[model samples]
Target: MEETSITAEPGKQEIVISRVFDAPPDLVFKACTDPELISRWWAPESITTTVEKMDTRPGGMWRVTQRDAEGNEYAFHGVYHEVTPERIVDTFEYEAMPGHVLLETETIEDLGGGRTKMTDHLIFQSVEDRDGMLQSGMEEEMTGPMERLAELLQSLKQAAPAR
Candidate 1:
């Protein structure tokens, strides 16, 4: 399994998270845009994720909720500015933080030979907000979901029926 890499430069309000997956670009793209597929691997193993709304198109909106073992809920909602097979741009805001919105752009690269690389570029409103996100166990939360995503991708690939 490829490990996730998260980079956040000091004094900057940007973060870049990336990982390689052992699947094709189309499959990766589908896994990302499909709400059902998203809920399957969008959260940590200890949490349950529900896709409250998802409309993969420009000017569309999306909402997701995650519940932990203790039943604590975390809700996130966003608006899609752009959506395509290879790229997606959206605004992400956690309901708990109200107005701390961040712009996120995810790109899916076809690395050839049944491999794909997914990269997320996130820009926060300010350095403080970016630092707060980094300090809030964001890396673990991101990594856990990524690992789950890899597993899901592998299963989907295997289930493709010799095509």
Candidate 2:
């Protein structure tokens, strides 16, 4: 299992999430940015996720929808502001809460020996918005999907021929 860490300060308008994957940086980044691979592990047990649209270049757009067990659909859309082998910067907003947007930057660090670390920083519109997310079971919601991501990466690596 991957170790995941999340920190959110009471007054700071930022959320930091980090996790180490047992895969190389390039493969980890591919799993994150590839729509097909992403759709497989981006949702928790009770929710089904689908990539509605994905464009992985700077200024490109993406939209994904998650449907809960109760059939409630939640959509999120974002525009990529920057994209590099090691990092990505994007805007993120839930469709229901239009203006409560945030800037998210994801960095993948090569940790040597086939290990990769991903750090995600989310700068929210305000402290209140950040706090609200923290209080809304965000950590619990993320943990499962992140674990799923690790599993998916492990499987992917296993399937690849040894290099």
Candidate 3:
């Protein structure tokens, strides 16, 4: 149960988050790029997720919507500008804050011994926008989903047949 490591430099328009999971790169990558697996662990416990669309290829598009317990829906959409076995590059935009787009790059590093490391770099349009997101409780918002992802990975590993 290691914590996700995060780095946010002052005056920079980016945030980086890193974590290791007890799974191989292929399985970890599938958990991220697959819509069904994403829906299982991409939202906080208080929210239910719906995968509107996902196309994990260069120029492909993806969208996800989440509904809170209060019945309020939140949506996010992005385009896949780059995709590979170990890295993904995409643009992310929250519907409520239109025009405030951010570029996200996620990298998966094989850590050996049945483990993989994931790092997400989120680049905002400006430092102000990045600060705004941080102020909006971005870390808190991500903590649960990340923990859920770890749990889901463990479950998936258990379900697989012996190699």
TM-score versus the correct structure, for each prediction: 0.98, 0.97, 0.98
lDDT of each: 0.96, 0.92, 0.93
Cα lDDT of candidate 3 equals 0.93
Candidate 1 accuracy as lDDT: 0.96
Ranking by TM-score: 1, 3, 2
Query: Could you give the candidate ranking by lDDT, starting with the highest?
Result: 1, 3, 2
Backbone clash total, candidate 2: 0
Looking at model 1, residue 139 earns an lDDT score of 91
User: Per-residue lDDT for 104-139 in model 1, tens only?
Assistant: 999999999999999999999999999999999999
Superposed model 1: Cα runs more than 4 Å off: none
Clash totals in order: 0, 0, 0
Off by over 4 Å in 3: none
Q: Which prediction has more favorable lDDT, 1 or 2?
A: 1
| Model 2 bad stretches (over 4 Å) | none
Deviation in angstroms for 113 in model 3? Answer: 0.3
Which candidate number has the best lDDT? 1
Better candidate number, 2 or 3, judged by lDDT: 3
- Work out candidate 3's RMSD over C-alphas: 0.7
TM-score of 3: 0.98
Per-candidate Cα RMSD to the true structure, in Å, reads 0.7, 0.8, 0.7
